[model samples]
Target chain A: MKRSKTMELGVGLFMLAGILGLVFLGLRVSGLSLSVPADTFTLQANFANIGGLKPRARVTMAGVNVGRVSAIELDTDWYDARVTLELDGALEGQLSRDTTAAILTAGLLGEQYVGLSPGGDPETLGDGDTLTDTQSALVLEELIQQFVSNMVRD
Target chain B: MIPRVIALGRHGCDLLEALGRSGLFLAQSALGWPSREGLYLWLRQMHFVGVLSLAIVLVSGLFIGMVLALQGYTILIDFGAEQALGQMVALSLLRELAPVVAALLFAGRAGSALTAEIGLMKATEQLTSMEMIGVDPLRRVVAPRLWAGFVSLPLLTVGFSVVGIYGGFLVGVEWLGLFEGSYWSNMQASVDFIADVGNGMLKSLVFALVVTWIAVFQGYDLIPTSEGISRATTRTVVYSSLAVLGLDFVLTAVMFGGLS
Candidate 1:
């Protein structure tokens, strides 16, 4: 009985260690940062489409992640997609009034990401301001469907 | 014509017997009540089954993860798609390897022991004496073992998955020289909580039920002989392992179907 109890204790500890290790690793990985620091004001970008845009998808400017897409929603009346972005405070000053938010494919058939083009507007877009001029993602399947229909029509 | 009819009748009889046995087993478990004594017995058994099987599961899980990473890296490298190694290892471990390996380990450790202990009790007339003495052996014996198995299997599965994933990370990052940050980042990005890890845990719970049920049922119905005990033990391992694999396929189909 004592032997069995000892064995049980050992196993329980082993399992606990494994579980805690996983939790630690998961937290560490999720906290990985190459983008600008977190202390930044959040911005909103309105797009017509955010196909494959998931929460936590990176917001890149010039191939560098400066922020992350925090939320996505649809405006019911206008039938437009609205994305909430969290921009690093340091980089916020660079985003001009003419900044265009384009939903772009990260790789061939990869997840969609928001790409920002810092426009030439001298005034910078503030925290609560929305970028009205946005480009939607190009859906490959829809493009193919259009192409096939055009071919058949021709 | 008569021989063919006889063969058809035999097949029907076999099917009916199997169905009846399954129905009786379910009825027994459903009708069984848990008293204080039964609860204590269950807790004790759980400590034995779950707590004792941890090390074996961890060691096996670690090796399995390492091997998967090594093999997956080699294959992906051949196609110059080595960047996807983390996702591959994480996906496979979560969806398939973790639960299956944990169930197989439980079958070998607890399942066999359950079979042998119950079979020995039957052979020694301990079970019969308990029944004669106005004790419900189902509640006292079978239920505890069954409950232990159901509780233990999932715990072991969680352990296996955690250790296994770490082992894979070690192999992929340290041994294979893959970028540690990118490997972990890809895994975190690609693996969804609902689709991969949650599905694996759900499958593990179901597999636990199947493993315990088969083990206890085989043991409880053992013939009154030493040879019977040996046979039951062997059959318990073989049958439980097969059931785990079969259930894995069915669960995979249902899970991926819903997700896709």
Candidate 2:
């Protein structure tokens, strides 16, 4: 009601807008969220080696991110890592039980993640079902070893 | 030996007395603050701190980011990891540079101004006249400026980070021809709102409190003379800067020490 109060409120609101804009941009830059949107479903895939494939790593198909690796655990019996993939709800119908997931690195020296290659199976994935076809992490040392062995054989 | 001991005792007593009085002054000002009158005065202080100080913050923040990108590129390129330029720049600015530099500048600009304005008011007997008429100068004069410091510093720090990030982007992506997509994506992937931004906001808020406290305390306790007022203004800037830097270390240790 008072002039000073009105001016004060206006300034407060202005500052608040600036702050909100800042938080929005900062979050976008940081890739963090206050509340994660709940339009996702979780699926499981196993890898012989996750090779630093951390939880919350991106899951991509055809180089497009459709999901994130929500959790990773080691199964002692198989000595493989079980990766839980939380994917966009829309992507649920697109994946099949026969989809072959591979742990792959981005760029030449970047973080590792799961890459899904589509399969020709009729059955779609569900909550508890796991993808049986998986490729483990490709270690550079092993590749070099194989390369040297090939040269020797030649 | 007796005289020396006595003098040391007197010095300690003086320090305690000053500390007690400053605490009382701050508490009274906060307690006696008039809400309606405070709103207007806060706006005035906010205008002085935020609008007037915007250019200095922007210029410094931009240069700081640009320098980061330029330097970060040199180091990251050695590993062929130039895409990480954004994350480096953003982390440094959001976590350290933006809050620390803006608070230092705010200490120089608005903190000194607040101290000078109040010190001059005291020197000119304006505060005395208000007191003589049964008005509390602490409520009318001091509280609003203090509250304004609390309000303005956070906004300025955030804006400073934004501008600084743009500066880094300009250098890393546009000037140096680094890939833009990776620059942005790597940054987003690394920076988290709760860890980086929220912690930064907390740091700035602490700095705001310390800087404003020093400014208002120095001005309110000014000796009511021209030289005294000027000296207090200088002390406001000096003490606020020192406190901000020192407290930043403690806060970082507490906030990020274990997390890292």
Candidate 3:
């Protein structure tokens, strides 16, 4: 049986539309971009606790996103959490050697992200430089526990 | 009491027999590549299943997304976290709602149609006639429909998710006065492509296989009467919906449960 040209055209259009939807989801929705900007650099920070800080979580300076947490692992030698931050290359040679990296929560019960505060050191940090002065994630439950214990003792 | 026990045993046997037959049917219809003519048949069936169902899927996706944003905003506003509405809506749609709901609609729309069409052909002795003419109705009829469903469903699911997310954006950003940049950026930050979107696609693929198999098998195995066709058609919708919901729990647990 011979089908009409219109039917074939409809199918072709439908398939194209579906593929376009998939591409939109990939690029626009999920942000699956293939190209990485050439100037991005990586920095490492070690923390006593990361407290739900995940890869791809934002790294901010003065409440503006400058990078993302790229990887996280436990350092066997130091017994602390090792975090890798992928920063925008545009900020290269700006961060001092003594910059403080702290894990901060967005809202009271919200996501955990890294907050970087610049230091007074004239020496600039480079790619893969480890931030020595770092503040660990604040655990609310631990704080409550300490408060209860101190109150009982008093 | 003994007669009732015997009846129960017979019903169990009947169910097992049907299950075995459908498994065999799936094996027969799903294997092997399509020849040139078979490709044309598949295309025609895709028209029936995919193209025809597009409007309903898109419309449902849009409304569902809008509703999700509205509901999530109401809840998140109490916490002063309404900015997370975009993330909530996108995650829920991509991870759960879009694929499952689209499949349920597909089962109701295309699955029921496939069952009825095949059942009517069987009732009219078309399948028997093909067999008498030395043509395997399984190859000529069933395979095309099965392949069409398998290919069409995943594409439709993607379309549903994309439309649904924008629907959320419309409700959350435009109507409700949420920040547009935060809406998109929060979604982009939280919803990982491989974890959330890929898992949803995987769920839809499995659903496509099960739903189409149930639709075709119920029709092919029907008792070849007007009442039988109607019963099979109803069964296709009921069974497909139940299977989709049930399998969703199992798939969610495996994919996102992080059991380890």
DockQ of each: 0.23, 0.45, 0.67
* lDDT of candidate 2 at residue A64, scale 0 to 100: 94
lDDT of 2 by residue, A39-106 (tens): 88888887887777888888899889888998899888788788899988887777877999999987
Steric clash count of candidate 2: 0
C-alpha TM-scores of all predictions: 0.76, 0.86, 0.92
List ranges where model 3 is wrong by over 4 Å. A36-41, A62-66, A76-78, A88-94, A107-109, A120-128, A141-154, B1-8
| lDDT per residue as tens, model 3, B1-260 | 99999999999999999899999999988897788999889889989899999999999999999999999999999999998888899899989998899999999999999999999999999999999999889999999999989989998999899989999999999999999998998888788889998999999999999999999999999989999999999999999999999999999999999954
Docking class of 3: medium
Write down the RMSD of all candidates, one decimal each: 5.7, 3.5, 2.6
**What is the per-residue lDDT of model 3 for residues A1-154, given as tens digits with 9 covering 90 to 100?**
6777888887888899988998888888887787976579999999999988998899999999899999999999999999999999988889999999999998777799999999999999999899999999999888999999999999
- Pairs clashing within candidate 2: none
Better candidate by TM-score, 1 or 2:
2
Ranking by DockQ: 3, 2, 1
lDDT of 1: 0.81
Candidate 2 stretches with Cα past 4 Å from truth are: A1-17, A23-27, A31-38, A74-80, A138-154, B1-17, B31-34
